[model samples]
Target: MSQRPRPCRWLRRPGSDLGLRLTLAAAAAVLLLVPFTVLMLLVATAWPPLLALDAHLAATLHAGTSANPALAGVLQLWTDMFAPGPLRVLVGVVAVWLWWRGARRVALWAVVTMVAGGLLGAGLKLLLGRDRPEFLDPVSHATGYSFPSGHSLTAALGAGVLLLIFLPFVPDASPVRTQRATRWTIIAAALIVTVATGLTRVALGVHWLSDVVAGWTLGVAVIAATTAAFATWRGLPARRSPQGGSGRPPPRDMPGRT
Candidate 1:
């Protein structure tokens, strides 16, 4: 008699499936909650911890301005690179490149994520109507409501989308260890860029510390949600053509079929 096929080994692995399920659930929770928290904080104007942290950070950064004019100037330049116009241009270029390479799905994902994140940030700014930091001299000048730093949000989204698009290109070997290492390296580099961009806004005194923090958190939520959506799409079963048949020959009969 024929025996039943063995269950998938991954399903039998201890904790792996549970861990992934929990992680995804937590990410969804954060994605839903962070924006609401930011909005409520803006309305209440009573986020004591964030307020105190903002005051201390802004004061510390401002105090260093005279002693480190050159450093301040460098940070100003870095912060400017994340401005909305520059970020739009950068995203446009990347999306076009991905399209040319036939990564249509990823290209569309990038454009949608960037545009949605920008609109969300802008809507928040207009709705909140919070003013920029004026407690100390600003190393750089800006205009507009400043509850969320647009530069920080754009930087995080751009860096994150690019990383996600390129991650699949890292080759996986049999052991899987090398692939994990490569992915971690890319993650580390992206984190550095995102963190530096947020910190520069604070150092320039154009945004309160809380604004940058909120921007980073919101940006991360957008990225996490986008990634989850993409993964779900990719996991879906492929559909047959209108003829009700697969377009390709049976895998076992195809040349070099795995």
Candidate 2:
């Protein structure tokens, strides 16, 4: 008698690869880091035992109060407005708005990333109720808490969100050359800005390094969640067409079509 065939796996589903990447990103950002951030925040807030870290850092800054204002002031230039973070987010938003144009789906997510990141950062700040450094008058002041640096969170979330937003269109299915370049270029740029903003806070003495770390973690988590949702939404079964060869299709199905 003929042997029975093995059951088919669900590996060949549409967007499966993209789904996997999304899953990986989510796990890395949320599972691995977010909880740790929460713990750090708690330590920074509840564990009066841990509160000693803040005290120590505060003392260090105080000791060096006259160290170098001119240098800090220079580094503090454009970064103070959160341009290092939100500015990049804005660039990503513009990409979606310009290239994707009327494509509501893409545009909406860019907006979602910017708004959600801000909200999450603020919410965490208030929830933790961690105070800002008393070392100097804040170049900027936020009324809420400050365990996780909002600038860092904003930067990380912006980076992650934009990366995911464009991941599906990376030209893998159709084999385009520049798609990979463009995708990577965007990712690299985002990382630079995100990291810079986080570090800026530390240099400004506005927040401790721990705050930046936590904010970065949470920001990454937010993007992961967004990516998973986007991938799931796009992963619904759809037949691939080989009619087009240059990565994207002809203008037929696009806006100006009959």
Give the top-scoring candidate (lDDT): 1
Give each model's whole-structure lDDT.
0.70, 0.60
Could you tell me which 10 consecutive residues in candidate 1 have the lowest summed lDDT?
4-13
lDDT string for model 1 (42-116, tens) is 545756776777778987887786468899888888777767678778878978876665455566667887988
Instruction: Give candidate 1's error at residue 17 in angstroms.
Output: 9.2
RMSD, each candidate, Å? 7.7, 9.9
TM-score of predicted model 2? Answer: 0.67
Quality of model 2 by C-alpha lDDT: 0.60
lDDT of 2 at 165: 49
Residue-by-residue lDDT tens digits, candidate 2, 76-180:
774665653555556465645534433444455556666776787777677777777765554433444667887788777666655554555444444466877
TM-score of every model? 0.75, 0.67
Steric overlap count per candidate: 0, 0
**Which predicted model would earn the best TM-score?**
1
> Pairs clashing in candidate 1?
none
Worst 10 residues of 2 by lDDT: 3-12
